[model samples]
Each structure stands twice: as structure tokens, then as C-alpha cells.
Target: MGTAGLKALLHRVRYEVLPAKSTEDKVLAHVPRDVVVTVTASPVKGLEPTLDLTARLAAHGYRVVPHVPARLLRDDRHLKEVAGRLREAGVDDVFVPAGDADPPAGGFEGALPVLRRLSELGSPFARVGVTGYPESHPLIHDDVTIQAMWDKRAYATYIVSNLCFDPRVLGEWLARIRRRDVALPVHVGVAGPVQRTKLLAMATRIGVGESTRFLAKHPAWFARFAAPGGYAPERLLTRTQEALTAPSAGVAGLHVFTFNQIAETERWRRALLDRLGG
Candidate 1:
């Protein structure tokens, strides 16, 4: 991609933040109101933290998209309550994922049922997002994952890819999805500038550890992130530029996983923007 196209993608980038104690303050201090912010729902903390932080961020004038994972909800009643809360807060966008919750809280075991419930509730939000895996999921078969996307096409407005380090894999996945006829605009997920140590520490704090199921299910991610040498997000972006800018890619923008390193992420983004001529 040309510098102009790269800059445009960066400009449309959105940050995904964990709903932790200090997340609200860090986002308020470092993130511009013009930038979109997506709050994550933690299985450990449940959906309360996600909803609370989203309401607070929306109040501050940021376009907030909260993760409303199916596993966290109890039933249709819970879904309605969640929707009502977001509507009261003026939130119009949400990202729904199957989530890591084992023995799902209620009837919803995956995103599709919750999506159907949302439509039954008259599609409360303007934009609803579902997860897409560029690489094979450790637990789910690749065929099954893509078929879920096909099943969800009628309900979801967009797709957000899971974080994948390999640009070639990302590009290939984009092409494959187009071939499959799932045409929703995609927000390619990428990690922000994060220290491996900091990332591991955050994971532990959030109840993920070496022996945790989270790490076990994402062994590939662990190996890549913990490998020798620093991880430069810009390099990944540069390598993936052509695929993203391609006409058939249908890429909407980027969804940066900050791991709550808000200041560092924002600084890195701005410096990159400046280096690319603002």
C-alpha cells in the first residue's frame, strides 16, 4: 500500500481495552475522543465491568463498542437488560464473541444464539460485530469457525478478526472469507506495542497463567509472543498492507489490542503517524 493508504488505515484504527480498575483513567488521559474504544468482557469479572466502563466512556464522548459475549449472559432476559443498559448509555455498537467462559452462564453457549436473540429484540444496536479467526482455532475446527460466520452473516453487521501475527496468514484468510461469500467489512485485529513481560503480567492478573486453559488453548499465541526478539506492530502492518488495501479485502479498519497499555499504544501510534508524515 502507499503511504497515503497506510495513513488512512491508521487514522481509522480503534483500540480494544480490558475493563480493569485503571483502564478508564488511562483511556481518558491518553485516547482522543475522536478515536473509537472497544471494551472487553472478562469471564473472570463477568459483564459488569465491561458495561460500566463502556457507559463511562460513552459519556465522555468516545464511540464505545463493548464486548457482549454470549457466555456471560444468563438468558434472553439478561440480554435484554444488557441492551437496555447500553441504550441508556447511548451506545450503538457491540462485539459479540463466544468468550472463554466454560459451562456458559445460561442458554447461550456461542455468539450465534445471542445474535439471534438480539435480532428478536429488534436489533438494538446499530452495529454488531462477530469474531473471525484468520488462523485455526486450537479448540474449533477451521471449517466450523468459518461456517459459524456464514451462519451469523444475517445478524452481524461486521467481523473482527482474532489477533494473528503472520501477515501472509491474515491476507490468505481475507481471501478465503471472500471466496466463502461472507462480505461483512472486517476490522483486522493486531496487538499494540506491548512488552512481553507486561503482557504476561497482565494475563496473570486477569487469571490467565502458564497452566491456565487460556494459554493452553492459545499455545501458538504464547509461543509467538514469548519468542526471542521484540515484536514490532508496524512491521506486521507494513507486511499486511497490500492485502488490506486490496479491493476484495473488505477491510474496514484496525482493531488494536492494547492489553491496557494505553499510553504506550497511543504514543506508538502517534509517533508512527508522524513518521509517515502525519
Candidate 2:
């Protein structure tokens, strides 16, 4: 498929942001008007700011999908309040993740619990997204992750994959998901063109080592990003593009991990699409 075909296939585009000093305004200013804008719930920033950011984006006429970390929600009441706030702001769609919290927050220990509660509430959202780790999760086992998705399928509308460097692994994972009958439309995650020094600095700041299991699975990527060539997301995207176009695969769109490098990412996206005549 060409660029136009690919563009036409995209239902939404997400831009993730931490609850930084000027993150909300910066993301709002840079994100395209036509696509959805998602605010990430980071361990450092917490949940309140993500909700506020999502509301702000919704006000700006973008469909906002906020990440609702399971541990951040204190209880069912808290979940209700969060859902209410999104509804009031005309925001729909959410990404539920178990989160990086050290301990469980009350009754909700993971995303499955939160998703179950959301289903019980009968919210107005047209979609609810769940995470899919194409690469190994830092802490969870592959079997456990697959089971989580199977359980979440009843509540989630789609799957947004975690960043993975290898296209073959991603494709194989997609096939596995299909075989398992967890056929939610997938949004393949890829990092946008990011500065090497900046990427490492941010990764270190975020304590990437905290997830040793994840590090163990992708030692090569860690080494590559740490080395001279650093991380270039295009090479991965190019490899995955054909897989994305495959007949049996239900790859929905690309979710660029801008890492706050929105301008560079957007430029790269446009240039590539133009080259493909999209």
C-alpha cells in the first residue's frame, strides 16, 4: 500500500507525554488537530496531571486517550471519578496498564481489575486500549503477558504495542496473538527519530534498569542505543511496514514514541509518507 492508503487506514495517532513542567502545552501545540492525543501516566508525574492534560487536549478538539495506571486508582470510586472527569470533558478512550507502581493501590492490582471495573461501569467510551508487549516486558513473563491480554480482550477495544526494535519479533508476536484468538486491532509502537544522547539520558533518568527482565530480553537493543549509531526508529519501521501491509495481519497504525521530540518525529513521518506517495 502507498502513503495515501496507509494514511487512510489510520484511525488515530497518539503522542505520549510525561507530566513535565510544560508538557501539556507543548504537546497540544505540536500535535496535529485531526489525530487523537494521548497523555501517558508516568511513575514520576503520577495520575492527576495525566487526567488534567487529557482534559486540556480534549478541549482543544483532539480525541484524548489518557493512560490510567491501575495502581494510581485508589478504588472503584476513584475509577468512577476518573471516568466521570473524562466523560465531562467529552473524552473517550483510555489505555489501561498495570503501571510501574511498587505496590498495588487497594483492590486494583493490575490492569485486568481496572478493565473489569470499567466494563461494570458501562462508560461511554467508544474504545479502550490495552498494552501489548512485542518486546519482552521488563518484569512479566511472555506467557503471563499473553494471558493478561486474553483476559483484557473482553474489555479492551484494541491493542497498542510496546516499543520493539526487531520487526521479525513483532510479526511473530502478532501471529501468536492471532493464534491465541486475541485479535484486537493493533497499533504498532515505534520510536520516532530521536537524538542518541537525549534518548540515553532520558532512559537512564527513568531508571530503565528497574526492569531487569526486559533488559535481559533485549540486550542487543540496549547495546545499540548505547553505542555510536544509537537508536534510529526508521530502520525498524521500514522493516515492519511490509508486515503491517500483510493480508492476515491486522496492524492498524503506527504509534510513534516521540519522547518529546515531536517536531523531528512529525517531520520524519511526513517525509517518509511523501516518499511512499501517501
Q: Give the winner by TM-score.
A: 1
What would the C-alpha RMSD of candidate 1 be, to one decimal place?
Answer: 2.2
lDDT against true structure, model 2: 0.73
True lDDT of residue 124, candidate 1:
91
Clashing pairs in 2: 3-278, 4-278, 138-214
Q: Which lDDT tens digits does candidate 1 get at residues 1-278?
A: 56777788889889988877899999999999888999888677789888999999999999999999899899888999999999999999999999888778888999999999889889999999999999888789998999999999999999999888898999999999899999999999988988788777766564331123344468677666667664789988988889888878999999998878899999999999999994
lDDT of 2 by residue, 1-278 (tens): 63444554343456655555676667666668876666777655568778887787788788878888888788888899989998999977888888766676566778888888787787557899989998777678997899899988989999988878887998899988889999899888776777777666666665222122233356676676667776676566666766776757788777766766767766776676666662
On lDDT, the candidate that comes out on top is 1
Query: Model 2: how far is 252 from its true place, Å?
Result: 1.0
Give me candidate 1's TM-score against the actual structure.
0.95
Alpha carbon lDDT of each predicted model: 0.86, 0.73
